[model samples]
Target: MKQLYISFILLSLSFSNSYAYQNKTTKAVDKIVVTKKTQPTKTPIKISNAIIANFVNKYPNLKTYRSDLNNLYLKRNYKSIWFGGKGLIEFANLLYAKTNELEQEGLQSKFAYKNKINSIFTEKTTKNLASVDTELLLSAMYLFYAQKVYKGIESDKIKEIGWLIPQKNLSYATLLSYLLVDPKALDKNDTAQFNQYYKLREVLKKYRKIEQNGGWNKIVRDTLVFELKPGDSSQTIGQIRQRLATTGDLHSDSKSNRYDQELIDGVINFKKRNGYNEDPVITFSQISRMNIPIENYIKTIMVNMERCRWIDPEMTKAAQYIIVNIPSYKLFFVRNGKTELESNVFVGGTMNETVIFSGNINYMVFSPYWNIPTSIVQSEIKTALEQNKNYLVENEMESIKGRVRQKPGPKNPLGKVKFIFPNSNDIYLHGSPSKSLFQSEYRAYSHGCINVNKSEELAYLILKDNTEWPVERIKSAMEGGKEITCMLKEKLPVHMGYFTAWVSDSGEISFFNDIYERDDRLAEILFSEDYN
Candidate 1:
């Protein structure tokens, strides 16, 4: 009986000890899960279904980002991303810093829910971990930034301004994938936006700094066309030197009230940059442009930077292409990244603003006929015919298929040749009879088409590769006294755009007249929030 009691007591003690150890082990497991909730670990914590559901309900417009976020968490089983035991994740901090400096990236919009993301750091404590929603918020803001900066303003918004170059489509999901592997790719992946946009951003910073530092003095408008020859002494000369020096057109301001050779050279450089006739004389018209405030220049740079963001950098890398800047009244022919030829061009008049678009030039016509549009016929030609019965005979025009068209001759408005790029706008690049307009500083005198100053030369260069159209044949056809059309062996792309401010490949900046007054309309939209 004594042996049986001792054995029962021993067995009871063993049972109690085993139960206590099991209870302790369960508590230890619970503690491990609780600790991991505040820090990153190999094991992940389950986020409440309510957190994601609530975020989705609140920000329905972020459906794409929300879907991405759900997939991201689904892959990791809903573990925290923007939070760890130390508090906010390193990537979250880096992205926040970058978002705060949006202006440096040529962006002016406010980040959504910025304060809430910031509060994660500001309100963090030893007892409190980051909110479950913090990761979603950061991810959402990142998507917004990527869309705005990389994709630029929506296609419809740019189409309102007649830009139809087909904005490049970007994938934010790809960006997220990169960040998943290497978070630092946010800084390294510059291909998201056009390379020119970043270049313009650097220039924007410099212009803004200049504006902040009191900028250049506005030249007092004078009625007299000041033609300051060398050795001419006047207070206006000193002021001109000072103004040019501010823009780096002059190395230094001599401060001597004389038109020294240095001032003359500076004027020529200024004229060339501004698309003037390259004459050393400073006319009243030129001075009027010079008096424009530096703040306006800064605004021009900003607006043009926005325009740059809309371009696809890859388009600039085409094997052969032609680009025309309406404001600058210039055309560039590029092949294999080298400028083959440049020509002075005349864009549309203010009343008939030239469209901004791209097309492929597939054919050329030598000694083309000017087919007068029905609108001009009903409006102006009818009146001219009423005044003079022999108007068609005098103008070398004849009725062809019930339409009055000018014959292909020397007197025809389309001088000798025309390049055809099919578009709905009926716009073509052609030579003009009024060659004197090319010599002028401002050449916005066209009805709607572009007038190429070197059309014959452009034709020769474009067709030189084909044995069918040799240089002699091209020249002979241009002056052959009859209309001849030649289809190109290979089509070339042509892009017509409006840029009031342009930064060249060599980093030289040039300003052009806003002939169509587009800058103000675009500025109104860009700075709409500020005005409000």
Candidate 2:
């Protein structure tokens, strides 16, 4: 009976194993096969042809936009589902947003519904197509057009948009584009606009480089030290430090007292060499100079390089010329390619800013007359007339029908001689009795005219070749109190410019205070993304 039971169990086990193996083989066969269906492989997003046609028809000028939309549809039209066709859907949304004819409510609803569609191309489609340069250029062109339209249309809405124009960035972008396209095309002789633009580019390039090199991370700790020669003695240090202290660099502190006298003397010598008054107390300015990043110096040099390129080529070859470096408050006279003379000059006051210009020296007047500007007469003389009826007489001022004038006299604002250049703005070079004003670093104290301290010397130099007048003869002519209108043998060029930073002739970099606050405005525009 046991043997019969064992045989039955063996037979049942064999049957169970066979059944499991058949079931496993059937499952493997099912996994190996891929079944075919009638559905398409790629899905398409839903876009109404009517809506697209209406949009294109409304903006007849947008043929290009419509064409791009058509291309998107043709490339991805295989998909059946609306959301799956990402490119077409995105094109539809952009069209809706950019179209002015679409009702705001309808467009908003469409945008909201379309945004729900998930696809690979969604993010790319929504990106801003306007690049920095393109936007800046467009903004500038629009600004130029808007001004013309603003003049024609008296509507406040038009004027408001015109006023909202980004002028600074636009101007910078336009200048950069011009330079990059044809740098040589910018006249080297026209320093006014060219120099300003060049300087701006330099500053911008420098700031960008600094930002690129991890910004202030590269800053290293440095102590101010006087530049020394290989075999200099230490005795002169204390005196140098004292001089430096007077110039606002050194503080009265225990830490400052620890500075060795040899170090002080070396700093003083460095200051003297670098065009600062010989002072030894190390101040913040000196510290800044010592610690300036290499990138900043590079930018400074580049800024001047651009300036050199922008300088009017005409000035470079002028036989005789006067250059007023606005930042330096100094005038340089070049005769036959040599620097003949230099003197301090007082420029326009803060309220009456000195304008950059270049013109020929047509004539000069001894004991010159002053023609007060119309704006000045209205703003200043009008107020003075109220205070005292004889105000004009007291100041040697006479009134014409609509202008105020000053006669040639001791009390005349125009001291001795005036160099007349026929400019529409009525600006000229002249001498002022307020000689003390020239001593100040911030010498903006004139009425839009340049006042030279050594006018007699300048007059002699300008007229020596043409007038047969030696220095003595020129002095005699001026002392005679006669207005002399001598024609220039060759009309000399005069250039007035503003530069806050420049490289000196000796190759040392120098920085001047931005007395006119012009640098900051320019910097803001140059450093922004749109300007690039």
Candidate 3:
């Protein structure tokens, strides 16, 4: 009995010690005491559930949401606590969608999470939401969503793939290449399309890098020695060196008359191959073409290309259309994809910069009356009247309710027929009596109106095919001294644009002076470190 009691007590003591240890272990595991450094608390944004629901409905594909998404975006409340995080996530998601790669899912998710956490800090939100960067991000997001929705239901893979292409880079060459090739062999499955899309993404990425590094902007000026035969080198080389030295091509051995003509000839041959004028005298322009920085040139191209994409692509295919390159001060009229008419135009000056826009030409006015803009009346007429009372009469001007107007005549400020496109700016394309102004490189003299030299011929050409009236009839109508609105059978599209630098149809890159100083301003805004 004593032995039994001692053994029972020993067993009970062992059980009690084991239970005590187990209890301690349970306490340690159950009550995890993590002491994190206290962070500044953010005030939660007050947003309406209705607004949240509406936003979700509008952007149904946007999977993630935050309380501040509505407040920050819809309400434009930058002070919202969750603004930064939500915006970042949205931006990251947008970029990921644009990549169209399944492999990027992991990275996209990580960014999305980081973006959410960063929003808690008010300081970060304020910094990121500065300028129009947020607007651009939102625009990109919307575009990506639209693309995805469009692609989802598309049955034709080639057609869908073609639609997926960024229209900004759809040059004549690229378009021709795509149009010529059949995308039937290319994979139509989502995975395959995604892979191909990634390949294009990679190409665009490398191209972007090359463009950013000024690869296209570098101009290498050299003279072409067309006199050289394929195998024969000496005479061709001598001619090249002579021309290089004369034209001041860089690296010309001034001392050595007997220079490497072969190298010079090779460069000339290369220039000829690249679609440049085969001139023996290499000018600065020629050199610029050779060594042009790709990034700078590409940016210029891309900007204009974006402008092109903004317009309906079908407009480009019209049988007849007019385009006024604002920066170049040139007008191009294309008929069935062929340039039928090309002319120099005088656009608005620096202070009164011509707007970049696209509009439809509704009618052409024969012997149109010049309705002076109110701004012109206030600035020019008022000042002219102050200088001389007889100024209006001397200039063949008529007074109409405290406003001066010019009568339509050869000597009138507006030469003849005016192509009127109703716009808020009260600007139009008209013939100019002062045709000499068009010859000037810096032609910005008009009061926010475009002056076309061959307006009559242009009008006749535009109306000839579609209208019943012959050129003689149109001339007679103008000669009758009456303003008649000739309605076009087919309303043509007009694109007035500003592009300081552009690649010509011949593939020669050309740069023009930013007469309105717009290019510099845009460049500063686009490429500046603090712009974002």
- Each model's total of backbone clashes: 0, 23, 23
Displacement of the residue 411 alpha carbon in candidate 1, Å: 1.5
TM per candidate: 0.83, 0.50, 0.51
Q: Give candidate 3 misplaced runs (Cα > 4 Å).
A: 1-295, 517-532
Over the stretch 1-532, how does candidate 3's per-residue lDDT look in tens digits? Answer: 9999999999999989966644443233213221111232244444444645654565454434434244334433433321343333222322323233322111111222224223322233433332122332343343333233212222243232222222222222232123225322122222213222323333334445654553332222235543333344444335444444332243453433343454455456545434343444444444444444445444554333323222334556768888887767788889988988887788887677777666678888777677777887887788988999998888777888876677777766666678877777667787887877776656666667788988877888887675488878888867656667788777787777665645544443345655766544444433444321
Cα displacement (angstroms), candidate 1, residue 21, comes to 50
lDDT (Cα, 0-100) at 142 in candidate 3: 34
Regions of model 2 farther than 4 Å from truth: 1-300, 400-402, 470-473, 524-532
Arrange candidates by TM-score, descending. 1, 3, 2
How far is 212's C-alpha from truth in model 2 (Å)? 13
lDDT for position 470 in model 3: 86
Per-residue accuracy of model 1 over 62-87 as CA lDDT, tens digit each: 55566656656665667766666665
Clashing pairs in 1: none
| Candidate no. 2 TM-score | 0.50
lDDT of each: 0.76, 0.50, 0.51
> Model 1, stretches more than 4 Å misplaced?
1-53, 56-91, 120-131, 176-190, 221-227, 530-532
RMSD of each: 12.8, 19.9, 18.4
